[model samples]
Target: MDSLLALLKKKSTGQGSFALENIKCDFFISDFDKPLLYTFAPFGEASADTISWGFEFGKNLDVNVIAISLVSNESWYQDPELYELALNLGKLANFSEILGYGGSMGGFGVSVYSNILKIDRLLLLNPFSTLDPNIIPEETRFRWYQRNLEWDSRFNDGAITCSKGVVVYDPLFKLDALQAKRFKDFKLVKLHGVGHQIPMHLNKLGLLKRLVIDFLNNGSDFAWFYKASRNRRFYPGYFAWMQSQENIHLTQRRKATITKCQHSLKKLISSKPGVDSVTGKDIDFIRDLALDNESKDLMKAKMLMEIALKLRPEGEFLKMKVSSYNKRLDGPDL
Candidate 1:
């Protein structure tokens, strides 16, 4: 049950660390000349006691970093303690530029506090505008945490304060799309099938660093983002999520969007022809494709699984999938 600051201080004892109520902040000074990056850690059980998001990324770039995290999930950062913390942090003159970055709950913090922190720019991914149920009645996803929140307070609506930043989100996700509408001033990058975990998915596709660095350094490059986003087609669970949407709640536009994505996937698969063999590197891609096909075409799933297993001989999950498909295929018709 160690505090985030305590856990972080174990590795580097001299760094600046502070805790006020449920909020914690850690400061790492890499260079006096480089811009400071403020990263807000998202809400999650696994990362509750870890350093804020973008710790290593900021360290690698030799920039000053302020890592902020809330120890408990109950507070959606509505604490008055933040204003006091921001007032002190805003006085530092080492940073030439002050930028904010965060995702989900973290994104909410970055946006809401941008003006007070004197943030020059920001990068928010799938951030909620406000957790106030009255304002966002359609959003029913986080009721457990929302039940006891003090929503009517200063700096509650991040959409009002977050004027300069890029907001990346999956437009096909109804709730996220609704959230995006609140950030009217910021530029929107609608990435369809990547879901709410936009940053993670982009990282998997080897695009997160380029996307983030380019934005924080040079504002934004829409053409570059669009081109890079197309690589989602090759992501492991991308097509599977797209194809499985029939069972989920989707807007009319989202349904049409998925249909278009399915068309593009079909063309991509057709161009690649058949998977004759798979190398160690290709095993994951092949395995994912196999799983995607399991519901619709068991025969094709079996073939791809066989190809993947040849490269990954010790793959127990692949063996199970292959066996299950074989049994279903060989059974008599009902």
Candidate 2:
């Protein structure tokens, strides 16, 4: 964490600053002398060192950044002092443009605070509109925040009226999609294959730096950003998601969508490294898909289990699965 802070401090020309220790947030005004970018760090990023590290990428864009790190998820919504400090910083900057940015919990902060900050624009990626489970029961991701919610009516209301902004998200990610719908005013930039981790996916694709620069330079012009980020089509995660969608269509008996999905899956499986380079959970998911798809084809299910076992050789659950498949193949008497 010290190293991360040192790296950020070394890159930017401005001196490091801190809000009241009670607020538990950090601020670093970039030396770039460009428009200020006010970024709210996501939950768990409670310190300057632990905040979002994407500021380094934006440094070259000649934008000044004020990275606000929160000590708790409830801090932003509950504390009026934090909001006042953020707004005052923008006022002090005397810059014509001030943009709010964050993803997930941070995204929620950007939306809620940006409205209050009255910043020129916003760039929210998969932001949660409300932490209230009653409003969005399907959103099960942020359980920590959900359980500890302070329930501020000011921020919790299902409305984020940004002057101009873009909400980038994956429509396939049901929770994020629903949240995006709540922000009916912002331009929606749907990146279908990537789930809740849009920034991570974009960083992996080497598009995040350019995308941030573009959005910072040209406020809510989503068309240009979308065109530049079309490389998502070639991403392996995207293809893997397509394959999963096809499998779903096949299960649902959606003949037309199934046919297209099949062709796409086949092409992806043949040429792309779908789920192979990803987590073991994804491999387990494929095994479950195989078992669910071909319950009668014990051989196919066993093959998938073998593959999963190879990846997770000591996985007891997988071993059990393999045993179950073997028993199914051997017959009830055996």
Which candidate number has the best lDDT? 1
TM-score leader: 1
- Tally clashes: model 1: 0
TM-score of each predicted structure versus truth: 0.70, 0.63
Model 1 spans > 4 angstroms off: 1-16, 45-49, 244-334
lDDT of 2: 0.61
Candidate 1 residue 12 C-alpha distance from true site, Å: 17
RMSD of 1: 10.9
Tens-place lDDT per residue, model 1, 77-155, is: 7777777777656654335788888888888888888888888788888888888888888888789756777677785
lDDT of 2 by residue, 123-235 (tens): 77777777778777887776776777665567674245555777788887677788987887677888865677677776655555556766787755566456535555545
